[model samples]
Target chain A: MAQWALAVDLGGTKIEAALVDAAGAVLPGSRFRLPTGGGSSSAELEAGARAVIGAAYAALPPGESLLGVGIGSAGPIDVHRGLVSPLNLPAWRDFPLRALAEEVVPATPVVLRIDGEAIALAEQWVGAARGSDNLLGMVVSTGIGGGLILGGRALAGPTGNAGHIGHVEVGGMNVPCLCGGTGCVEAVASGPATTAWARAQGWAGSTGEDLAASYAAGDAIARAAVQRSGTAVGQAIASATALLDLELVAIGGGFSRVSPDLFGFIREAIARRSPFPFVAKVRVVPSGLSDEGPLIGAAALIHRADYRSEV
Target chain B: MAQWALAVDLGGTKIEAALVDAAGAVLPGSRFRLPTGGGSSSAELEAGARAVIGAAYAALPPGESLLGVGIGSAGPIDVHRGLVSPLNLPAWRDFPLRALAEEVVPATPVVLRIDGEAIALAEQWVGAARGSDNLLGMVVSTGIGGGLILGGRALAGPTGNAGHIGHVEVGGMNVPCLCGGTGCVEAVASGPATTAWARAQGWAGSTGEDLAASYAAGDAIARAAVQRSGTAVGQAIASATALLDLELVAIGGGFSRVSPDLFGFIREAIARRSPFPFVAKVRVVPSGLSDEGPLIGAAALIHRADYRSEV
Candidate 1:
């Protein structure tokens, strides 16, 4: 009988679920999602969670054995408390996400973790950093976030927020974040932040895609904005590499693709630490997974269970 | 009848050795040392290693069995290859320190790791961060270095250099390091560096002790220098906490005690990251061990062997 796990992903924008097999493949037609936002009510969220989880589990093959249910949610998540409080979803503060998953799937074990950690596991399992034991998997979309795999195991930390790289202040950056901190990589390098910086510099682009188009058309300000974000990201990566002696960093999301030279700029920042070979040797590359990354990562919470440490 | 391991610590200016029992205690009268500065010839270093090991071994009780030999040396060390090349020790370039230890203590297994890592293990084993599995042990002296224990195990990244926090640049700092990196914690906060900055600022302090005296006397320049270094160290620690989610950081060395309020300054900088609870909550305390920290740390290479991951 084929073995599978019901994978659920909760984010600021939506709740998604899918049936993932032992080999990390998502069962065809098994994926489901429901739109959600900061404005969504608790009753609506509970209904959406039920719908997606049930739909995905219902699609499991007749003879397939369900290993467990794994959930990956946006932070700040307390894996120890099995709660989630996504920054963009003000309606779900410390929501009992794990309990909800368990209520829907009685008699089955449920595992919960931060989405960034799930992504890192997924990347190591079958994405850009395939087979690499030590890597940082990052998302650079509306906000920047990351997860770590060290010595082939996930580092969940005390509260399951080990890889909150977006909040890490980048050296020399002065941008302020809504998180009330200055110089956070998210404040300087996230898609909206990068776009805003470019607009402030008179580029007039209002979105990541618009900025990408402008950059492709050789708009100097767009190029400079992308360069600035990439540089900041590289600097953060370098600092992280120095402290952790990481082997590689796999970055994904909307802004990472804004300019083909984005990675080059990040590399340039890392190069500044050439005197420290360990930091200089760390590799940075685009994330290998597609938009399905979040779901796949959620699935990895179960598929890569051996790599996880208890909270 | 007590089990004991022979411990060795090699540095730029000296080589030391002792016998540490399974209980983590250094057997009285078992410790010995020899001076071997940068100008020491290859013959002098080899003789020093042999003499220290032989003396420590001779002090072993008549009936006690030996566990093994453990060496902690100044890095960049290639633990996998048993090589060491301390930057200040011009005579040893990738010197085979491990082999020499093994040759001196012929029948026992030998383990080698960077000194910083050894200190972290010792701290967790019997020092300030005792039993707190996830922590960083740092030295703030003529130079700055550190080691990490994550999930109750020492994290020796590939190449045995996981916790090199000294080079992690502080946000907004512009100090240049000899390592070719700017704003490195060591460049801005090491004992000599802090003193040098004070001198550059027209303070007459010539040593850490001199600066400490001035700080006691209310000298404004000395106060500023200590504050600057403490803030830089704190910023670096905050960055490290965000990346690693560490629970505690136990610091030691001459400069760490330069002023009673030095810790207050470090805490003040960390407080700037108050928005980040995980980083802000991390505790920073003085080292629980004394000048014997290095020797005990070297012993922990054997005493706390289980905490280490193979390179």
Candidate 2:
């Protein structure tokens, strides 16, 4: 009988659940999602989690045994406590996410991991970072986040917050970030941050899409904003590569799609800014997974031996 | 029959070899050393290595069996090719340190790693970070170097160069480093760098020790220089902690001892500069090992299963 795992992906805006097989494929019609915005209360989040988990479990095949449930939540999560304290969701502070998932799938193992780590696992398992023993997977949407796979294993630190790359300071820029830090890559490189910078620079763009269109139109200000964002990201990557000796970085999310040249900009900045030959040699690539990347990575927590959460 | 491993530690100024037991203790009277500085040629290094290795082996007890050889050398080393290109020793560029060691102890399993990594392993095994599974070991000497033990394993990346912390930029400084990068921690916090800064600031200090003495006597410029170096180290540590979610950082080397309050300065800087709670919470401590740290760490490459070199 084929083995299956219940995968849950909880983000600031939504919560998703799916039944995935050993091969990392989400079962057809097993995926479900529920809205979970900043206004969501603890009760509402718990209800929403249960509803999607129920829908996913209902679609599980009859003969396949459910090995476990894997959850990837927006961090910072306390894997030891099975709780989540995601930055964006104010109402769900210290919510017992793992316990709630366990209630839905009683007597089965439940694993909780940060969303970035899940994405890295998916990419390393079946996407762009396949065959790489040391890789970094990053998302550059409304917020920037990343995960690491070093020595062919996920690096979940003492608090399960190892790959919090967005918070690392970006040199020369003293801009305050939402994480209470200054000069963070997320403050300069995230889609919203880039769009905000473009707006402040007298470019008449209010959204990332508008900025993308402006960039495509060859507007100098839009180009400058995008380059600045890419430079910040590249500088952060250079530092990470210098520290981790990473082989590749796979970037995904909305803002990274603003321009194909964005990657070129990032690469150029890394080469120019990095002092070590090893760091300069690290490759930057786009994530090969689709929208199901999160769910697939969540499932990886149970399916892949190396990525299993310590708790 | 006591099992022992031959440990070799190669630095900018000297090469040392010794026999180490499974308990991380170096055998008395087995340790030998040879001078190796910038003026030393590849042939000299080879001869020195053989001499040390032969002396160490000659002192091996009657019933003890040599398990293997573990060598930690000044990097950046090409572990894949068993070669070393130490920045200080230009004559040893691409020099096959591993091959030379293997010649001294043929048919034994040979392991190679950066000297910083060796220190990390030693600390993790029996030094300041004994109980901690995730820690960083740093050397704040003439040049800054570091190593990491993450997830209960020594993190030697694809090239055995995972923890090259010195090269990471210290945001505000634009000083160029010897490694072709600007604003590196080594450029600002190294002993030579701090002394140079002190000299440029009209301080008559000729060495780190002189600066320490001046600071002890309440010299303002000397205090400023020491504080600046400590602050730079702390800022770099903050960034590294932010990225790695490290539990502890054990600092060693001559310059770190320049001031009793150096660690306090580093800690205060980290707390002040870091925006994230986790990064600020990481502990910075002194290395627990004596001068035998490098040799113990080199031996750990063979003694500790987690630190075994992939090559």
Candidate 3:
């Protein structure tokens, strides 16, 4: 029987639970999802998480002993304390998630990591960054977040916020970020933020999907808004590539799919703006793992023991 | 007899030669200098470097075997080509510096590195970053250049230009960088750039020394310009700290001494603008090696085996 572990990816709107093997391959029919509400209390969220975990466990192969649990959550997480205070989930501030999960499954070790980091680790382990010594995994979804894998190891600083790239200042008009900084990449280029900015500019689009459709229909304002987001993201990446000398950037998440033209524009922007030749060559590509990036990466956090040296 | 290595730090205006021991300490009277001129051809610069190296060698204690030679040059240097194309020394582009130096001191192994990396390595080996795993060493001289040490290794990427922080965009009013980037930290905050910007703003300051005197004498424009440089530098550092999870930034070079109040303002700016709590706590302190940081760090490239892993 194949050994298995429970992988959970927590986001603002939903929680995804899966039974994954060491290779990050999910068991067939072992995936489940649960919705999260804004007004939901911590207890409600915990109950929802338990139900999803129970569903995934029931589908696990017979006689296959559970190894451990790996969790990827929206962060400002304390890896040592297993606590998280994600801004999107204000009610879950300093939430002791690891302990709460342990309450349901006694004596089973649980590892908690940032969602962005999980994506990066997953990429490094079995996806785009398979042989790469240096990699950055970017998630340009509801918000712009990222994770870093350097020297073939996952980078989680003392507070587990090492790969928080969303707030890095990119050149733009000052827009207030949820993290309190102004003109951050997330504020300027995130899906919700870009759509909101486009709507405020009189574009009749309320969602990213609508905006992309309008862009495909040659709506001038919608095209301009996508270009603006792409430009800010490119400019910010040019700076990061220069600073870290990153080998590759794997871009995953929903908004990045708004258009292939966006990534092409990003490459051109970096080429034009980056002062150094080597930095411009830093590849920015799509993550090979799409919906499964976070869950796979969370499992990779435990399976890739070579990554421990970086911590 | 003490084992000594010849350390050469090649800057735009001057080349410093020192007899550095394994511990990166300089011997008395073993320090020598050579002036640089724009009109000087590459051959003349080579002759000048040989003379300085000869002088330092002569001053060293007799009967000591020289282990090797370590050179740190102001960069955009191609380590593979052993060539430099420093903006400050345009005439010396692609100059075969290693071969020329090898001719002067035949058969001794020569190691070449960027001055920024040299300083960072030296700092990591025996200075402020001795116990730290990740640090950024910044030189606030005529130009703002820096080196990065991540995961206990100096980071020199494919082209030996990993930590080019000067080009990292951190918001400066429209000014072109020598590196062809706009709004770069170098364009806004380098010593000469700051003084030039201040003078262009109608402040009666022709030099950093004059600006310091003017700031001390209660000149609002001078103080504002200085403060702006610090703020830009601090904000850039905050972003870099967030991206890399740096532990400390050891600041050196001539302009860093403009005012003690400048550093305090920088701290305040970082604390105010940093989106994450951990990024705000990154320390910005003066260089422990002072004027010798470049030479010592350059020598460290040869002495420290781990430091060579970057190459």
Candidate 4:
């Protein structure tokens, strides 16, 4: 019988649960998903969570041991209290997601790891950052999020916001973030932000997909917008590297794929900091995992218990 | 018998060694120091290390066993390889201070930690941030340097430069750092930097002490200079807090004492980021340990073995 962990990944738009075996694979037919959006009612949210979680438990193979349940959510989560108040889901203020998980899977240990940080754990366990324990994993889609694995351990910090890098302000970039900080990496680099920048620069693009098309066709505004976003990201990464001394950073997400040149621009910006080898030595690469990265990482939180809530 | 570890702190201007008991006290009369300048020849530097190490060994109490040695030096030190190449010490590039200590105290393990990061260990163990396991310790004198105590342990990243915040560029700061990074916290906030800016603004102050005196006497330029440095320091701290989720920050070094208002300016800048509570909640205070913090922290690397060289 294969040892396993039930992994739940809760995002702004959806909730997903799956049984992931020790090898970081999602057991076939074990995955379940449900939409739980920003406008979700309290009752609707719980119902959705129950549906996905119930399916995950039902998929458990009989006689096979279940290690624990790991839930990865959007953060500033109160890991100590097992509560989550993901920014995009304002209706769920300090919602007791852990308690809900416990109710669904009684007597099993339920651990909460932030979704962003879980990605780093996944990358470190089996993806791009597999061989390097000190890594930062990033997602640059509708909004930017990141996770850190330092000293071979995934960090959740006191508030499970250990690797909350999106809101960190970037130098010389003055865009206002909804987080109320000006020039945050998310404000300058996320898909919407990049698209908006291109539109403002007189490009005809209305979305990331349109921007990617224009970028491939060599639209000047589109190319400039991508460079601007990637450069800001590189700047933020340089600051983070200065503080954490990370060995590798893996970038993933929809907007990051808008152009391969996005990475080139990032490298150019980092190379400017070559005066500091620690910053320059940081290897920035595209994340090697598929979309299932977060789920696989959530399971790793339990399966790789030695590095657990350092998660 | 009191258990003790030898601690050596190597800086640009001096080398100091002492025996510190497990209780975090430097054994009285066990401390020794010698001048070691940036221009010192390799032979003179080795002689100074020998002198300090020999005195520390001689001061060790009879019949008491030695716990090992910890060396703290200005970074970027290679903790794993036990080599250091501090910027100011031009002649001692990649100096084998760890091996030198081992030769002086044979059969004893010697661990190397960057001096800036050592300060954080000292703060966590016995200073203002003593009870907070997650903290950033800063020195704001001739130069600004910092260390991180994250999740209750000091961090020495791959290169032993984990908490090297001095050279991280600040968002609005445009000052040029000697390290080739623009607007680095050190270039914008260090004592010498502050004094230079004040002088450029026609303030007659030529040193940090003069600026402090001028500010006390109600000089506008001096006040602005102080605010400039403090605000920059606060900005860097906010960025660091965002990345590390620190609980407290203990600050020392000569320039920090220029005015009580310095802390107020720092608080004011940090308050601007109140939109992010994690960044806003970092408590900045004076160092609780006296000037002996670095040495005590070095000894801590061995005495507090659980937290050791996590230093």
Interface RMSD of 2: 2.5
Question: Over all chains combined, what TM-score does candidate 1 have?
Answer: 0.96
- Highest DockQ against the true fold, candidate: 1
* Candidate ordering by lDDT (highest first): 2, 1, 4, 3
lDDT of 1 at B58: 90
Count: clashes, candidate 3: 0
Model 1 residue B58 CA deviation in Å:
2.5
> Who is ahead in DockQ, 1 or 3?
1
Ranking by DockQ: 1, 4, 2, 3
Which is the winner by lDDT between candidate 2 and candidate 3?
A: 2
Query: Lowest summed lDDT over 10 consecutive residues: which window, candidate 1 chain B?
Result: B173-182
What TM-score between 0 and 1 does chain B of candidate 1 receive? 0.98
True contacts kept of each: 0.51, 0.47, 0.41, 0.44
TM-score (all chains, Cα) for each model: 0.96, 0.95, 0.92, 0.95
Docking class of 4: medium
lDDT per residue for candidate 3 within A133-228, as digits (tens), equals 777889888888898876666778756778878877765346766555556788888999889988988998799999889888998888888888
Docking category of candidate 1: medium
- Give stretches of model 4 more than 4 Å off: none
lDDT of 2 by residue, B1-311 (tens): 78999999999999999999999988999999999999988898889989998789788899779988988889888988889888788899888888888887877888889998899988888899988888999999989998988878788789878898997766666777665555678889999999999999999979888999999999999999999999889878887887889999999999999998899889987887444667778899998889999999999998996654443
**Residue by residue across B1-311, what tens digits does model 4's lDDT show?**
88889999999899999999888999899999998887898889889999998899889899998898988898878787788887777888788889899999999888888897778888888888868878888999988888887787777777678887886667755566666555778888999999999999999869889999999999999999999998888878877777778889889999989999999998887888876776788899988888899998898788766764442
List, for all models, the DockQ compared with the true complex: 0.57, 0.48, 0.47, 0.53
What's the best-to-worst order under TM-score?
A: 1, 4, 2, 3
Better of 1 and 2 by TM-score: 1
lDDT of 1 by residue, A47-149 (tens): 9999999899889788778889999898878888899888788888889999988988888889999998999988998899997888999999998999999
Q: What lDDT does candidate 1 reach at residue A247? A: 93
